[model samples]
Target chain A: MKKQIIYSLKSPYRENLDVIGFTFGSGEKSACIVGSTRGNEVQQMYICSQVVHALKKLERQGEITEGRSIMVVPCINYYSMNIGKRFWTMDNTDINRMFPGYEFGETTQRIADGVFRQVQGFKFGIQLASFYQSGDFLPHVKMMKTEFSQPEKMLEFGLPYALTRKPRPYDTTTLNYNWQIWETQAFSVYSYGTETVDEKASQVSVDAILRFLSAEGIVRANVKPGYVSRIIEENTMQQVHTEHGGIFKTLVKIGDTVYEGQVLGEVYNPLDGEKICEVKADKCGTVFFIYNKPLIMQNSVAYKIVDF
Target chain B: MIQTVAENELSVNEKLKIRKNTYQNGKGKRISIVTGTHGDELEGQFAVWLVGDYIKKNIGCLNGTVDIYPALNPLGIDSITRGIPGFDLDMNRVFPGFSEGTMAECVCNAIVEDIKGSEVCVDIHASNIYLRELPQIRISRDTAESLVPLAKMMNIDFVWVHESATVLRSTLAHSLNSIGTKTLVVELGVGMRINKDLGYQLLNGIINLLYELGMWSEKPDFEVRQPIVSFDGAVGFVNSDASGVFVSDVEFGSEVEKGDVIGRVLNPLTAESEPVKAVCSGLLFTLREYPVVYGGSLIARILSREEEN
Candidate 1:
């Protein structure tokens, strides 16, 4: 195992944009984990805990041995993290979008360069994403759309749900999205709903990683493999946007089966005491996620009803 | 035209000077008042000048020393812009500014210092050109309770109670809270013009505000109507998907009902009109003066509630 230090992106008003990564093992096979991609919560803390947990589980095994090494770069946007903002406080840009990372670019692009060097990889890249508001994840792994044939790395994680998603416009240049393009198997874990840190999901993710290592030749252990889970496609997704902006008071909970035209929540207008908004599912499905923010603006997301 | 300002710093907008005056009945309350934060919203700056002229002509209204950073971002005033000069930064956003920084930061730091010692601060503003906002005093309900009752006296149309966002980097009035200063935020009239009526209204409001607090002996006449408030109060937007003369259905301040036709987005090419309606009932707070519309241009903001007696 080896330790390395790196500088962060240089923004106008803040510091701590620096990052560091630790790698273990050597040879043709390697793996990387970068969490808290978003400067807010997903990275650097809760998800970082999951990776630390995985590393601890891997340590007891005689697997990461003589030839293989693992690298971990947790919480890249320490400057934004310091300010408790979602973007670099100085430039207000997402550090995640600066990929293939730049050396002399904007504040974010510079940060992109810092982590890009750490994540160049040997075998797999697991990026955990915590949903905004209240979308409880079903323990899914979003496999590469084109690289579905290489599900072996992901399947070894042994989670209940592993669905593949095509990259969205705002999604391109992302760690996983672009990583998939280079034939690097990438997975975006929808860890848990927004603003929440669940212990259960951590255990699920950590257990999955240990199982995956044993499944591959990395670890010589009693880990079970080949007991693959269900694979869902992206076609079964439906998003619901609230028509009005106001305090979001949800009436239904996640994991609740809902039908088309179901009342998900109400937006209360403070101008006059009234419920002016009605959110309904357009198709029969199950509720997955909803926003935690009550004071929403027009066109802000309200909920996600996955059509079953 | 550069002049060495206080403590020998080069000041921008060589055309203007830091007009210092205090309003304390010989007792000195250490008051600071600023206006024209946004160049386009000139009513406040005009009102400040009017008041400033009166103070200069006679004795000061302030007890302690007073500093007036009128048009703090002078370049914004020259270009009629909302942001500070050079960096396109909103001067209001960069509060407690940095010393070794952009021009905007330099000015902001200066303003914060100018009012740092003040016990009561006031930041004045103006509405956009198309709409008329009734003269009012805006007080941060989230701050100390000492300023609440005074805010009630501003005699405006609405006393908005809003939560603080991005603290320490809030509005000028909001920033004053961190320094333990009681601040009042006032806004009225259309932007860029001196409405004689609004000008008079604002001039009198400030006088009354200070007089009530014992800064002045005379009272500024206040409007008779008690203000109104709502949550994010009454945001009613009327827009035309079709272009034409936007014939308004109701006057400003008129009560509307759900599904009521508030106006029409008319297609002048075909001489046909599409009804511009209100999906939710509310009061008509603002309307577009220019009748012609390019698709998606908003015509009005209705403060939604149709219940009018």
Candidate 2:
């Protein structure tokens, strides 16, 4: 196992920001995994760190396949992470949105360009992604439904669910989308949390990556066979939104099987604690996501359920 | 008369409403003015008020409909955020939006539908708080032939014909232009604050544009300055070499020769100052508004005259 600095930016007043990648084996760049482009994505970063640890152990035990290399970039925006900022601290720009970046562009673009140049040509790209909305997602592997996308390959992760999302206009700039466009089979792994670390979910994510590597002949480790993932279209998920903005009290957890007209949560008036409205499930399905935040905005998606 | 362009219900029993004020005298060409797509960009707020007030006071000068759509992202404006407050999404990046999409997309779709067929539209904006931009109309090269002529009459200092690759396809201007609306994006001033002079300058340009489009009956008293059109000019970007509070030595929008001292990055603890110089002789259209700088922070962008020549 070799630890290498993939990209570095010299800071004038502070320590230079370095994007470090941990590589296992040598020869073909078989797979690359990235985590936590945003600062607050602690869980995503933690999962990558665990993957690196597992890969290091596997390589030491000669389990890593010869003539095949895998790269794990645990965290990219550590400068922002150090300051607890969600985006680039200097400009508040998302590095994740500046993919296939320009060398002569702004600070984020340069960093993106530098990083993308290093990670672009890998056979497979996996990103431990965080949701735009602050919530908990059921552990799954998601792929952008681009021309280069192969949804069947996502099942190799052996996660609970494999999701395929249609690429939107804003999605074209993302790393996962750009990777696929560049002919790399890209997948986005969504674990349980972003800011907070979920031990169970992190273990599941680490195990899933190892399982995939073993299956793909990148590594020769004996890992437990995970779930046969159910393929689902991202847009097909039933979104349950709250009708009132207030203190949210969730009655069901993620992965709970919910029935139609079942009360999933309740929005209470913040000032008086009066029940303003009940957020009931409109479809019978498994709860795939739950809003973890205490304060709920009206029309905000409180829960997302995948129909049975 | 005030009209609601788009409306969406928020969680707190309140509504996200995009309103526009219309001034019409008779049947004629329609012109639309859009502003406040970004909540933090307050320069457009002043321009919207000024234009709406002017049209109201001088209703006699109005020959056709003048639609002034202000505060496209009202929640962002209300919360003083660059994007939609709860969604954490940039309102400007979801243009030509999907009707069956998220709330932001639906609102954007409605806005696009409402402003689609106008003869001419001026979308106003201000730079982020970190940078101050001179009054400029930024047009993509693809639409430059048609839009540049209209942009010149807007009375802006610079008509920047940017390469189409640099323009985001999802931007309101790009989205509207793709659908055949003659939309011109006007960017000026700094974020979070109103620039009255720049606002009035844009207002005059809009008035001049109204007359040029045959939407205004009377000629305005103000004289519009012919803008410097940057079709082939390369923009010189000046980044800071040292991190500290930047103190500017030159004013924004001033022409400077190559190697000219634009600013100094001062480290107070060491009392050391590093000079930031110009890379080319050009018009400094963009300058840092926020003083804080890092090693790679952008200090200024100059429109190079060498390429133009």
**Candidate achieving the largest DockQ:** 2
Per-residue CA lDDT of candidate 1, range B57-128, in tens?
645444444455566666678898665543434566667665543334455666676677676787778775
What DockQ does predicted model 2 obtain?
Answer: 0.40
lDDT of 2 by residue, B34-65 (tens): 99999899998888888888888988878889
Across A198-292, the per-residue lDDT of candidate 2 in tens digits comes to: 99999999988888888899998777889999899999999887776788999998889999999999998877778999999998999999988
Please state the CAPRI-style docking class of candidate 2: acceptable
* Segments of candidate 2 deviating more than 4 angstroms: A243-251, A258-283, B9-13, B269-273
Per-model TM-score, in order, reads 0.47, 0.93
Q: Residue B92 error for model 2, in Å?
A: 0.9
Model 1 TM-score, all chains together:
0.47
Q: Local error of candidate 1 at B88, Å?
A: 19
Residue A253 shift from truth in candidate 1, angstroms: 1.9
Model-by-model DockQ, in order: 0.02, 0.40
